[model samples]
Target: MPYAPKHPCTYPGCATLVDAGNGRCERHRIQERRELDRQRGSPAARGYGSRWRKARREFLRQSPLCAQCYVLGILRAATVVDHVIPHKGDSKLFWNQSNWQSLCKRCHDKKTVQDGRWK
Candidate 1:
């Protein structure tokens, strides 16, 4: 029998379908894509500042599968480093690797809109 993606992620309150890429359903997948586009199109992104550019590249290089995707069994390409906690109050927390997670475009959007954590 062919493999089947598990329906309903194992995690509590997770809405992603395990089989879907990035672990999210179609809606979440679309959201992730849009978030990636916004990031790439951002003015700061275009500046090619050494810090920004290097961090972006390093983040991607360090992770392959989206962290959320992995949790739900979807292994899509990851493009963002998600912060576990918002960095607004603690700028020093921004650079902590333990605080970062890889996420596909879809999961990234879900996080952003749901909590505005990345904004």
Candidate 2:
């Protein structure tokens, strides 16, 4: 018997019906997979930018103790300023000091990954 499917493609406006097991029609599924690949392959998604590097050094010199680490009982010494909300599309977010926080490399990376800070 031919297999029926479930969970049609989640692409923005795609209307092609999906399969019972995979959740998407063949074409829509391929498109979705490609999009996922692109997202994963993006430069920004890989890590910080040149601007972030510059800002990080200056921030670290100004404040060396990781704030969140202290709060979390980690006591990590080295720290970097991380934007609470990324400044990617909104350059105005770059200079908003209030939106910045000091965090250890480990905590910063974990927070960004767990909560998708740069993503």
- Model 2 misplaced regions, further than 4 Å: 1-52, 117-119
- Alpha-carbon shift of residue 16 in model 1 (angstroms): 36
> TM-score for all predictions?
0.54, 0.50
How well does candidate 1 match the true structure in TM-score terms?
A: 0.54
Clashing pairs in 2: 4-20, 5-19, 5-20, 6-19, 6-20
Pairs that collide in candidate 1 are: 32-105, 32-106
Tens digit of lDDT per residue, candidate 1, span 1-119? 77766687544576666673345656755777788878668645444367756886888897877988898987799987777786653557866778888888899899888885443
